[model samples]
Target: MSSTPTDARLMDGSGLARRLVEETAARAADLTRRTGTPPCLATVLVGEDPASVTYVRMKRARCEKAGIRSRHVELPATTTTAEVVATLEGLSNDPEVHGILLQHPVGPGIDERAAFEAIAPEKDVDGVTFSSFATMSFGLPGFVSCTPGGIMRLLDAYGVDPAGKRAVVVGRSAILGKPAGMMLLARNATVTYCHSHTADLSAAVREADILVAAVGRPRFIKGEDIKPGAVVVDAGYNPGNVGDVDFDTAVTRAGLITPVPGGVGPMTIAVLLAQTVDAAERQLA
Candidate 1:
């Protein structure tokens, strides 16, 4: 029996992120006008890693464009875990700061989780804290990990409901994979997680109605693994602007697929700004 061919749709995350950023800018302006204080996002960078620096710079530029203020905290490469925690605690207590974002991979020596825990749950706009994870898992009203939150938003924009769908998340990192799975679970998707150690990764992926590739390895998910008509969300950002999934071939099979540069990257920052505004609004209330 010959199966009907599927014409895949490109999920335009860039377009959606643009609209979201515009809305966030307007809301930010309104909030500032009413409260006499602009929403402020505090960015904490542990080292001078070129990539991390660039990411923070981009975030600050976006905040400025959105009428939000930014407070930057730069630390030495050799900063200890306790020192990182102290800095975050300071930002957490600062009433002028509405949100806090700590750039990930704060070098090998530091205890990352301890530093993440230092940020107050209310100020954790990047949604890296355990509190945010729990809230997202339970479908509670709280900040969510920006990338996962953005993925959900994209799904909503494309009118793809996660309810009762099989979602296969490749990777189990705290910020990306784990949170993505939890968010899908909250939306009533039957979620499965696969990692480096999973046997038959391709088999797991082929079962997905919705596939989220966030394993951070370039072209790690092959096209043959993709189920026909599945919604594919590529959240990986590897070197040379490559995604975890092989987009070239996956696009042919996926009902909807997100491109690398224009997909999950833009949405991540858009969600951050939106959550920052939300944090400010809550503080004002």
Candidate 2:
């Protein structure tokens, strides 16, 4: 027996990121000519988590490509929370620094929330600050968490209007999963959030018109869980660059799906750059 192939449109985040970067670079050049001061993003990371290192490196490399300066601070693994906060505090006060991104998931014993709060709202380009989250929750114009921002952009690019849809987001991280649900809610989607404590993950996923898998466990969501014709956003950045949903089966069930590495990952950095430039524009004003 022959099976009919389903049409699941693949969302190309890498392609969109490239175009955004080109436009951003042009704007960065114009800004250089206007003020003779280039926009800079200060990246602070504690310890050497491989994933964090890769992410920070990617950010700096993208910044250079976009003509945005990057100042990197690699704190020693033994550094105390106070020292980390002090470093970020100093960067927050620097007028020359247009944006600040403290790479997520600091070492054990570090107060991540306290460190995030130390960043000036204007310079919190990564959108990890409480001020930023509050604004995002209320649908105000402020920096959004990069991964969530990217997911919204992806939805827009594909013409998947969230208005009146049943949107389900798995995971509740302050940065990725939580903000994504809030973004969908702001766009008029009825959002449901599920985490480790949820009783039935599959049931929650099936009710979604738009399902976002961001639980960080590779292949946690199976194809059987997806609602047919649902729009799937896989925002998981796990080991081996795999996503939370089982892509092979999900594509058969989904109307659209974002791939792991080239999907939300690229878009995250693109959003960061855009926000950084926006911060610079605000500072310039």
Pairs clashing within candidate 2: none
Evaluated against the true structure, the overall lDDT of model 2 is 0.91
Question: In order, what lDDT does every prediction score?
Answer: 0.94, 0.91
Model 1: pairs clashing at backbone N, Cα or C within 3 Å: none
Error of 2 at 192 (Å): 0.5
User: Could you tell me the TM-score of candidate 2?
Assistant: 0.97
Q: What is the TM-score of each candidate against the true structure?
A: 0.97, 0.97
Regions of candidate 1 where Cα sits further than 4 Å from its true position = 1-6
lDDT by residue (tens digit), candidate 2, 24-85: 89888888889989999999989999988987998999999999999999998888889989
Residue 90's C-alpha lDDT in candidate 2? Answer: 98
Worst 10 residues of 2 by lDDT: 1-10
In candidate 2, position 95 carries an lDDT of 90
Q: List, residue by residue over 82-187, the lDDT tens digit for candidate 1.
A: 9999999999999999999999899998999999999999999999999999998888989999999999999999999999999999999999999999989988
